[model samples]
Target: MKKIWEFIATGFYSGKLPKMPGTWGSIVAAIFLYFFWPENIVYQLLIVAVTFVSSVVSSQSLSEQLDDKDPDSVVIDEIIGMEIAMLGIKATLPVVVAALVIFRIIDIMKPPPIKLFEKLPGGFGITVDDMFAGLYSNILLRLLIWRHYV
Candidate 1:
């Protein structure tokens, strides 16, 4: 039971990956999502929803366990944010590459309110900040797509 809770809290061990596991996890999840669903908006949105909720819950739980503030190891937030960034965008190689780079940059820089969100306590802070990052990335991606293709 304890182990199960830990696993769930840590994003099924994806959070435990060495180095920037969260980024890696997000990348993998995005790749898998693209391959599995391809151009399906429904599937992409579903993935975003699930990732958002799960990341919030998991980040909070993991923060409690670690007894530290927003440990880098717990990266479910990144995974969720990445999914949000990719939502509704075509899963083409160029788009995916652009989204990944943009999302990572925004996430790392933690601009404006995104940086502000980190002030919140525990998992809420961790997850919400990244969600905002994802949202920022999403908006930019949308504009880029619209400008170029639409």
Candidate 2:
């Protein structure tokens, strides 16, 4: 059913929060990552990879259904991006919160290659831009951790 697809594509309705739904989606994802992430980094990475692949597919479908190139109600991309940000990183309160903030900022700003990636067709357009934002946030968070900044 379309409702079922919408539910999954919306990241369990966090994307329907009416305002800053993307931020809400990222927060939920960070919480999920903190509480239930696999102890093994390999498995965590695998989950991120799987989430990314599946998000692309689901986002494309949802986009088509909504007749939009990138629907706000599709936040699987945010979840995937949050996972990318959390990858291989200890999910401490400070670290997780910082990653979430950084991800939100970068995702919102859409600087450089982040904007470029958003130009891709279909779900790749919807999902990859956030992925790059997550990658950027991850690198910054890693550096901050290395420097005891967060």
Candidate 3:
């Protein structure tokens, strides 16, 4: 059971990579977006919903196993966040790349409410901040798409 949660929390070991595990997880997630992103907005939303619940459970479990507040190796949050960032948008090369960069910046900077989100205990705290970062990215990309900038 622990191993199963570990696998999920670590993004199937993408988080085990040396240095910048979050970045690595996001990269893999971007690739996942490219290959697996749904065409319908409704389905895209469903995927995000499922990912959100699973990521929360897996991340929380792994955090308990490791006895850490936010384990460095748990990157499922980043993966799901990236998925959310790409929601309802066309998965073009430029869009995917932009989502990746924007999500990472917001995630790292942890601005405003995102910073506040980090205060929650357990996996909710660990994952919610990235969810906000992804929301920001999603909004920016949606605007750019609407304006024909992206």
lDDT, candidate 2, 27-132, per-residue tens? 8898998888776899988998888887888889899998999998889999988888888898888888899989999899988878989889998889899988
Worst 10 residues of 2 by lDDT: 1-10
* True-vs-predicted CA distance for residue 70, candidate 1, Å: 0.8
Q: TM-score for all predictions?
A: 0.81, 0.95, 0.95
TM-score (C-alpha) between model 3 and the true structure? 0.95
Provide the overall lDDT of each model, using Cα atoms, as 2-decimal numbers: 0.75, 0.88, 0.91
Candidates sorted on lDDT, descending: 3, 2, 1
lDDT of 1 by residue, 1-110 (tens): 44654565455677677777767756765675567644778877877777666666777776777787887767777777777787777777777777887888899899
Candidate 3 whole-model C-alpha lDDT, 0 to 1 = 0.91
Query: For every model in order, what is the number of clashing pairs?
Result: 0, 0, 0
> What lDDT is obtained when candidate 2 is compared to the true structure?
0.88
Candidate 2: pairs in clash: none
Residue 149, candidate 3: C-alpha displacement in angstroms = 3.5
Error (Å) of candidate 1 at residue 58 is 1.4
